[model samples]
Target chain A: MLAEMIKFEISRLLKRRTLLFWGIVLLIALFTGIIEYLGMGTPKRTVFDAFSFSTSSIMPLLLAPMAGFFTGGALVEDSRSGLLSLIFSKGVSAFEYVTSKAVTSALSQMCFIGITLVVFFVALLPFFPMGSIYIGAQHYSEAFAYNEPVAYCFLIALLFITAAVAFNGIALLTSVWVKNTFVVMAAPTLLYMGLIYVMSMDATKVSLIDPYANLALIDVYIPVSILHMVCYWAVIALITHVLAIAAFSFKKDYM
Target chain B: MNEVLQVKSLTKRVKQKVILQDVNLSVSEGEILGLIGPNGAGKTTLLKIVSGVVRASSGSVWFDKSAGIGIVPEQAALLGDMDALQNLRMLSSIRGKIGTSEIKQTLKRVGLDPDNKKAVRNYSLGMKQRLMLAQAIMEHPKLLLLDEPTNALDPLGIIDLRMLLSELAQAGTGIIIASHLLNEIERMCDRVAIISGGKILRQVNLRSTEQTPIEVTVSTAYDWDILKRWAESVHVELQKLTPNKGLPRGILKTKMAVSQVISELQSAGIAIESISHVGPNLEAVFLEYAQLEGGVYR
Candidate 1:
């Protein structure tokens, strides 16, 4: 059932009309790498920096809210357009319906991340030789000896993924109550930004239970505390997602 | 016959307004039951409740001898971006009932080309409705519930649906259809329940062999006393009666000789402005009952 859901969802996302959104995102990532390469005259940036540049600055603005809006929109559209009814009519319960969506959206996000990893790595491989030349010419030979922050990069990558997965759950939750995609997307994004702003005001007491507030922890280097904080938020998101599915299945009516 | 669906005292409320109240009805195997009513009469709501898409505030719905219920909502609920075949696959795979071949057969019966790869959004409304119906029938539900199944169907499509439903019923499936088309209901239903103001105003059985045929009409400038006396002189059994303001309308029906009524009208000097022969059809019953319930029929 999960496989079938994934197949149909991927088919829907691959439709011609939706291709532009995907194209634009990929183009931005490629262009950002290309411009940075041309300006610096070399690819001295580490893999961590490349991934960080793509996910943090470019992807965050669109990908974060887009994933949320898309998930939420799909849910509401299924209900309002009567697609949900047709599924239920076939003997599939509400629990299966909501779960399949969450699963599918997470898988799609994972696919996107995988593609980004491939694209950035392949693009930067050719420029590494030139990067060595520029470093030698600048008399900064120690630049080649710089150790890759493999652990920190992996942690940040995990952090980014956790945030995306949590947003999918949040989008699924919004779908139960808000049929309009605009409202669903805006509400969570605004609340997340609001929480981020509030956290900036007072960093004394961090509530790791709130996933929205946890995005702030991703910016700095990965310490044991931040990893624990991310894990705490992940647990909270999982619990909220379970409760959301319960609310969707056990609720008396659509509001 | 095995009972397919049994709904008892089902009530639904929305924001303090009653949408359905004390509604009791059942559909048995090999039966086609029509749920007919005017707009806002809760016909769709009743169907939704049965389909499990909408929950009833206070009621119970039991389906067949089975533990599960299948539903086909009024809306064409296919994914807009997916083709008809894909939609069928999604629904069938989830249910774990029926196979690709079964879906193809059902779709073919409904004149939908399962091989066509056109997105559902590109399909015409009639085609979409047909696809939706195909999805429902493919489930092979013991109790088939539909809401305005022919809403967007063309003349031929409506005929095809009627024939398909009849065939399904003959195959031991119970079909409950909610529609405003009284003529179609008259031609199809084995039994019918007319609802109004969230209440089951009446239930009718079309297969009942015993019935009385009567022609009745109320016009202006007719005295109630004279009409009553004239009806009595003819010895007509008032099978069903209701006051239409001062012009009370009654089903002055009888199995007596037809000549008896003519002779009595002549003898009593009763002016017969107009009269219609009401048969065991839904139109007359719906209109009469709707008026009796003090509701307007649109």
Candidate 2:
């Protein structure tokens, strides 16, 4: 039963529509990066610069919330459709059901965003040749970016996917009571914008606890290690996932 | 009869109010148990508790999970996006026990075309009800829990449902049905439980050939004054059904056999224009139980 639940949930989260949605989002980000590069006064922008600029700005702004949108109201929708009761009636325990939802939501978003970032970087490499000398701001780890640009992009992709998983969990948590899909999608996005605002305020008074910067890995705040933010955002996702499971376990699904 | 389920000392309290109190009920193999009660009398709650959708505050419900359990809720518990085949296929994937042929057979049994590719959202209410029934009985469960199974079913669909349930019961499935259709309950159930105030007020065995409630409806142009007096003198329970003077005389229900009721009515000098046999009158019995819950007390 657990295996079947996992199969169906993964199927639910990994629809072709979700893939198309992420594709369109990456295309928009790529075009935006191209337009921004055209407006820049420099002609020596490398492939790494294009990738870094797109990942620096658009990933946290769009992909994380889009991840939330893809799977936010799944459980609540199931509750409203009477599928929850039907599934429970079949003897599938609560633990297995929640586990399947959490696992599939995180795993599907990881696959979507990870593939999008990799594709975006590859798509830009031919357009912008790698230069022997590179200069860019907001790279967070400039030494690592210039020396091992590919590794740097993968690390950023890893952090972005982690944040996307956390945002998805936040959406699922809101799904416990808020059945409206728009609110579920908008909640974590607003939080992301809010955290960025709080982090980008007057630098002297700015707090280092910005979740948005933690994932974006730009404008160093407390210089938290890359591994540390990965664990931190992963823990945030785990906490929300746990809360969603706990709340959903007690949610009365008469539908 | 083999006992398939036993719910002992079951009680459910939501907030401060008690929904179900000491609901001790059992369903035996091949037995159809009908639960009839007024709204808020805990009938649905009892079914939910037994179906494991709701937690009972106190008590234990014992049943063999290996034999399988089928359920039909009041509303359609189906995926609107999926076709009937897809919905059943997903369910079949859970246990991986049955194949497509069995699912198709179950769909056909419930009067639905298995090949129809239309999503359940496009299906009519009756079709949805049929699909719900199909999903429930796909595994040929030993125990079936149905709440308002006749909801949204057309007359033909209702007949098909009755026939299918009868077939399932004959094949040794213990069924518990909660419905407001007293006539259907009388015709389908071997036993009827009248519940009120979250308690089982009475359990009536309707299978007895001799003691089964037999309603004798007599159509007449005349009033029912004489029959009323005769009923009072003999201490037989008489109900003045259809008292609109423009209609029939009345329908008199009694525990007596058909011959006795007709002979007694004829001897009472009542002109019987037309008399028809009817099932036991549960309306008054249900009202009697409802009075206990402050439902019909005047």
Candidate 3:
């Protein structure tokens, strides 16, 4: 039943609106190309430089909400349509259904963001040179990107994808308590920005845990370790998914 | 007939608010039990509990584990992005027992065009309601639970539903319906359980229980005394419904047949201007239990 549920949820996601996700990816890539053409960043930058710039500029701020738009309020819509009760009547447990929603929402966002990030990098290849991240010589340059340029691009893209998944989970979690469509989409972004604002006021620890810095893999004053930063967002994602599943599974009344 | 379903001491509470309390009811095979109540009366909650969509805080619902169950929620539960066929197809795929032909036939039965390409989102409320009914009845479950089944339905759609439900009952489907439409309930149900304030006030039989009292409306040309005497002789109660400003009218509450009451009134030499048995009006009974908080109902 869980497999069937995932299969059905995936099919529903593949419906027309998901094109909007790919549209955002392409739009981000095109904006990067335009900025590079205008020579905004360091001159003679590589595809790795441009892609990293794209993630830093957009992935931390705008991309999380874009992830919200992709899959956030879906459970609410299903509940409003009375589809959850209908599906429950068909013998699908609440746990299974919510798990499928979490899996589909997270993986779909991750896959879509991951693939589109790579495509954005490939699309930047012709415009920018294929030099290494080692030549950037900037204060915030990713040393992980210095040795193997492709691996660096892939790892940074994976980090951004993980961030998307976490924000998407947050959106899904909020929707369980709040039914409004707009709130569900906007909640994660607000939380991200709000937490960043609160953390920024802490002068000592702020440098080590800036959410935007962690997500884009670029530190502001001091670089947080890559493994610790990755684990931070990963834990947030796991907690959100767990809360969403528990709330839905133990819900007293589905109506 | 064997009992197909039994609910015992069912209660549901959310936080400090109680939604249902010690509500006990049952349905025999082929029986249609109507659950009638006003808003906030826990009609939908009780139906949800029976349908297994809502859990009771404390109680038990007994039924055969293998019997297929179908439910029509108060709101249409459908994939609005898909057309009717596609919605049914997706649902049917879960059980893997239904085929395309049956899906099409079910759609046709509900008066929706099986080939219509229009998405369900664009459908009118009546159409969506019809589709909801279609999905519930498609698998022919032995136990059918319907909540506000006639909502947003056109007259024709309602007539279709009446026929369909009656047919399903005839085929031995045990049904429990929660609706505000008392006339429909009186017309269809074998018994009605009146619920209010999260409790079952009374379960009145609409059919098969001959002892159910009949309310006869009467207007007599003679003084009200004549009718009162006749009512007293027959051991029936007489109460004036309207003020004596118009032609005097009174209601005779009696377990006797309408024919017998009519004959008795004639023999009493009472000039009967007009009189008729109102039969059993579930609406009046629902109001009676709803308005009077203290009584046998309490």
List, residue by residue over A83-170, the lDDT tens digit for candidate 1.
7666666555667777777667766655665565456556666653322222222211122222323443455456555666666677
How much is the lDDT of residue B12 in candidate 1?
Answer: 99
Q: What pairs collide in candidate 1?
A: A89-B71
Q: Which ten residues in a row have the lowest lDDT in candidate 1 chain B?
A: B64-73
Off by over 4 Å in 2: A14-19, A131-140, A177-183, A190-207, A211-221, A250-255, B220-222, B241-269, B273-279, B296-298
For DockQ, the strongest prediction is: 3
Q: Candidate 2's residue-wise lDDT over A1-255, tens digit each?
A: 778889977655543355686677677876696778668776477887677666766675676568667767777677666677667767777777877888888887788888887788788878888852254444655555667767766677787888889888888888777877788778787777777688677664343444333233445445565556667888998899899888877765433
The C-alpha TM-scores of every prediction are: 0.82, 0.89, 0.88
lDDT of 1 by residue, B3-110 (tens): 888999999998899999999998888899999998999998888777667899998988742334444567777777778888887667764667888888988999
Once fitted onto the true fold, the runs of candidate 1 whose alpha carbons sit more than 4 angstroms away are: A1-20, A26-30, A33-48, A128-146, A203-233, B65-70, B216-252, B259-278
List, residue by residue over B55-96, the lDDT tens digit for candidate 3.
999999887645657889888887778899988888877666
Q: Total backbone clashes of model 3?
A: 0
Ranking by DockQ: 3, 1, 2
Q: Order of candidates by TM-score, top first?
A: 2, 3, 1
RMSD of each predicted structure: 5.3, 3.3, 3.7
iRMS of candidate 2, Å: 2.6
